[model samples]
Target: MNEFQPITVSRRSSREEREIALMQIYRQVLERVPYSYERKAMAKAERDFLSDKIGVRRFLKELGHSRVYLDSFYYSSANLKFLELCFKHFMGRAPLNRDEIRDYCDILMKQGVHHVITAILDSEEYRKVFGCFTVPYARQTKYYESPKAYLESDILNHEHVAQRGRAVPTLYWHQLGLNCEGGVCITIEGENPALQNYHPEMKEAEAPQGTRIQQELLELLHGLDAVEAQRLVASLHRKQDRA
Candidate 1:
C-alpha cells in the first residue's frame, strides 16, 4: 500500500491580492502616503466596496471623498485653476483649450467635485490612454526638462508656481530690464515710451510716436548691427507713411 501524500500550494486569496494592488495603486496615484483624512476616507471606501473592486473611477472617487482633496483642490479659488489641476493630476496634461476648461468647470459646478473627478477618470479618453492599472504621468514633454524650464514654460504658470510654495523671484524680470509690481511688468527706464508710462513714479516725458516706433524696432532687432537695425527702422517708417 502506498502512503497518501498531501500537496501544499501557497496562494493569497483574490480579494487580499486585490486589496494589496489597490493600496499600491493608491500610493502611486495619490503621490503621497495616506494621511489621517485619507486613511479614514479609505476605510469608509473599503467598507463600501469601492476600494475592493478598484477601477480608476472608483479610486479617484475615493480620493475626491477625502477631506484633504476636498479642501486642497475642490475649494481652490478659481474654477479654471481647479480644472487645470485636475488635468495635471489625473490626465497628466494641461487643459487643451478654454473650451475644455469651461466644459469641465461646468461639470464641477453642476455635478460636484467627485462627479467631475469620476467623469474624467471614466472618460473614454482616459480609459483608452491609461487603462485600469496604469499610473497617470505628465503628458507634456516640456515637463521632463529642467525645473527652471518647467517653471518658466507656459505649462506651470504663475498661479501654479505660487501654489507650490516656491518663489519665482522677480529677479529674472529685473535681469531682463523689466520691473514687476503686483504681478504686472513694466519696462525699466529708457526701454520704451509705452512701457515707461506704466511706471507712474518715473516722471519721464511721453516719447513721440516715431521715437516709440524706433524704440520698439531697436528692441525687436536687438541682435542685428545698429546700422542695419536703423536702416530697417527707416524702411519700416517709409512703408508706414506710404500706407
Candidate 2:
C-alpha cells in the first residue's frame, strides 16, 4: 500500500458514537472469520496491521481496558464501519471481504475484557456475589459432524458464541431494584451477610494472558504497518546479502 494513500473516516463524533461503532465491527468479524486457517491468518494480519498503525504502547493500553467491558463498545453498527476503513488503510488491498472486515472489527473491540473482569472477580467488591462457579469460556468453539462420517473427512466447520454464564452464577432475590447510571443494582454492599455466607468458594484462576479486545485492536494497527516494516527489514537483509 502507498504510504500516503489518503483515506477518509468519519471524524470523532462522540464517545458513545465511537463505542457503538466498535461494537458493530466486532460482531461482523466474529461471523466472517471462523475456522483455524482463516482465524490464524486474520489474527496475524490484524496484529501486524495494528502495530504499524498504532504504537505498541497505545495499543496495549487499549487492550488492557478492553479486558473488562468489551461489550460496552462492541455490537454497534457505526463503529464497525469506521474499523473497516481502518483495516482498508492498513492493508493495501481489500484483504477482508466487506462482511468479514465488519465482523473482525467487532471482535477487536473486546481486546482486554478478560483481564479486567478477572481483576474485578478477584476484588473484595463482589467476592460474595461471585464466589460460586467459574467464568464460562468467553469464546467457545463447537464442532459439527454428520451421520456419514468418513475417517479422512476433516470435521466440518465449528460454531462459536460468547459465553454468557460466568464461571460462577449468581442468584438474585426480588428486592426493589435500584435505578442508577449503572445497570440493575440488586445488592446493598456490606449489608448482605447472609448472601455472603451462602456463597460458594471463589476461584482465583486467571484467563489467558494476552491482548483484551481493544488492545488487540490497537496492536492490530501497528501489526498492519509492521507488514511493511518487516518487508523493509527483509529487503535490507537482501541488499546486505547481495553486498
Candidate 3:
C-alpha cells in the first residue's frame, strides 16, 4: 500500500501494533479502496477488529464481503481474474492453474460469495499459513504442500495483475511457451531467476524427510576440506559422548 513496511506481528502484539497491521491488511485486500473510514462497512469492520471482537482473518472475511471488493473484483472482473485476485488477497498467491480457476468459478456460481469466502478462509492451507490472528501475505512456494504451488507463485508473485490492463486469468497466456524460472523458464542462459530461492515447475514430488536430511548434511559439508570434515565429525562425536 505505502512502500513495503515490515510488519512484525504476532498474537501478543499491542493494540497500536495491531492497528498498523490492519492498515496493511486493508491495503492488501481492498486494492481499490477509496478511504477506509469513508466506507461504512470498512469502518465498522475496523472497529470490531480494534475492539477485540474479531481477528485479522475475520476482518479479511468482512472486507471480502464489502461492496468495494464485490464490485471491483467479483462483479466487474472476469471470474478467472477474480479467482487470482482472491488467491492474492486471501491466500497470497496465484491460483495453481486453469483447473483451480474453473473450480473456484464453479464454487462461486453454485454456492455464492459467502461460500467463496468460507472455502478459502476455512481451508487447511489458510489455517496453516495465516491462522486466525495473522494477516495473509504473499506466501512463498515452500509454504504450500501442493507441488504446483511454487510454480504458480514464482511465476505470478513477481508480475503485476492484469499487467495488460485487461482482467483475465493469470495463465491466460501460459500455454504459449511462457516457460518458467530456473529450468522451467527457457531464457538466455544467465537471465533466468536464481535457482536457489525462486524457480518454477508445474509439479514435483517432495524428497523424503530422510533424503532431505541427507541433503542438508551434504550442504553443510559441501565446501569443507578433509581435515575440516574430520574435525566436524569429531566435534559431533564429542557432543554425543557428552549426551
Please report the candidate that would top lDDT against the real structure.
3
Deviating ranges (above 4 Å) for candidate 2: 1-77, 89-95, 105-243
lDDT of 3 by residue, 66-157 (tens): 78678766776544556777888888888776556666766876788778877998899899877888877776643564655676676565
Please write out the lDDT profile of model 2 over residues 93-182, one tens digit for every residue: 121233344345435545533433234334452234223221111111133132222111111112122111111001111111111112
TM-score of each model, in listed order: 0.49, 0.16, 0.63
**What is the overall TM-score of model 3 with all chains considered together?**
0.63
Can you tell me which runs of candidate 1 are displaced by over 4 Å? 1-31, 46-52, 140-243
Could you say which candidate leads in TM-score? 3
The lDDT of model 2 is 0.28
Ranking by TM-score: 3, 1, 2
Report the lDDT of model 1 for residue 31. Answer: 49
Q: Which of 1 and 3 is ahead in TM-score?
A: 3
Candidate number with the higher lDDT (2 or 3): 3
Error of 2 at 172 (Å): 45
lDDT for position 32 in model 1: 52
Prediction-by-prediction clash tally: 0, 60, 2
What are the lDDT scores of the predictions, listed in order? 0.49, 0.28, 0.59
Candidate with the larger TM-score of 2 and 3: 3
Among all windows of 10 consecutive residues in model 3, the one with the lowest summed lDDT is: 234-243
